[model samples]
Target: MDAAPMDATALLLADSRFPGGGHAHSGGLEEAAARGLVTDEPSLASFLLGRLRTAGALAAAFAAAATGGGDLGALDAEFDARTPSPAQRAASRAQGGGVARAARRAWPSARLDALLAAQPRPHHPVIVGLLVRDPRDAARVVAYLAVTGPASAAVRLLGLDPLGVNAVLARLAGEVDAVAADAARHARTAPEDLPAPGSPALDLLAEAHDRHHREEVRLFAS
Candidate 1:
């Protein structure tokens, strides 16, 4: 059977209801919210914006790389090396493992099940890209996934109004587009050129969250 082109598949793979385990993650927003860094709508807006310019964009690049027949192992290592904390890596791997199992069931194409089956582990963004039909399609799926998980995590972590976070996504539509465009550009850059600089405060928060022993902690530092 022929595969669908990038544009059509982009919508399918990026859907919030994609049965993936992405719902459990906050893309590190849970920690941010806990620290009062993203308590309300405006703060949420700024946090989302910062995410786009940094790690979110880097995820876009990895998704693009995975989409372009790039090696999954290489992408995994690159993402891992860029991540500053061990807890962040563990969280990502957990998400990636969950999503990879989901992909083996959902798409089952390009021999993805077997491909993921062979890994030490699959990264969420890498698996996310392969689920789509092309790099361009992968870009949308990963970007939307990156933002939504964190936003969802925020709502639960802070007890913020659910409708408000959705509104945040709705409000950040243009910024999302800007991030996507930048993601596309980064997709083609050398692996050495990928963005690795993340917020120092965010990193510190994640590290601190580990020692707190809270039942609601969701700090995935990287």
Candidate 2:
């Protein structure tokens, strides 16, 4: 199979400025930072790795499942089941809704429209998976986002060196490919059977952030 189309679509959607509103959310990095869980470059790297393995793995799998055109409703429920925190669930749907709206305008496909009609707001990884044709590429997009959001937020919140923060991402490139491949392998599996790696600490942080920052100003949405 030719890889050019898949590569291009993945690159386009992976861009932080993809009009998908991905830049508005910090992927829970802000909350972690406030709690001192991620205060420096080294801490940020650790947090990203943990996320890439847990939430990141789940996102990649779900995106790959979406690529398979499975029952999205079941997929959505499976995704929610994996996410234990209400705050995190809301964040995922909000980001999903943003990505879905942007993708519909950009791709303009019947399948995308049907996905929206089926659910007014789908999971972010699910919508991303539906937009990209290659299951591996879909996984790649979500895995990349898993780190990029927090990495970007770290730069702003901690005033960390941009060069150093990006180095953390570049260092994880191999793992990103590995995660994407692992996720794509299950593209044909039942939605309930997909990987459900969860990060309990991240979920707790998200709930804490939402509970405390309801009226306070924050740099990131989640």
TM-score leader: 2
Query: Alpha-carbon error at 143 in model 2, in Å?
Result: 0.4
What is the per-residue lDDT of model 1 for residues 1-222, given as tens digits with 9 covering 90 to 100? Answer: 213444655675566676655665666676676667788878987887777667677777777777666666667778888878766676667767777766666667755865676673577777777776466557667777767777877777778789988999998777666666666665555666666757566556656666553545434432
Q: lDDT for every model?
A: 0.68, 0.88
Total residue pair clashes for candidate 1: 1
> Lowest summed-lDDT stretch of 10 residues in model 1?
213-222
lDDT by residue for model 2 (16-133), tens: 8788788878888999999888999889989999999999999999999998878988999999999989988888898889887777777898888888998978888898898886
RMSD of each: 4.2, 1.8
Provide the lDDT at 25 for model 2: 82
TM value for model 1: 0.82
Leading candidate by lDDT: 2
TM per candidate comes to 0.82, 0.96
* TM-score between model 2 and native: 0.96
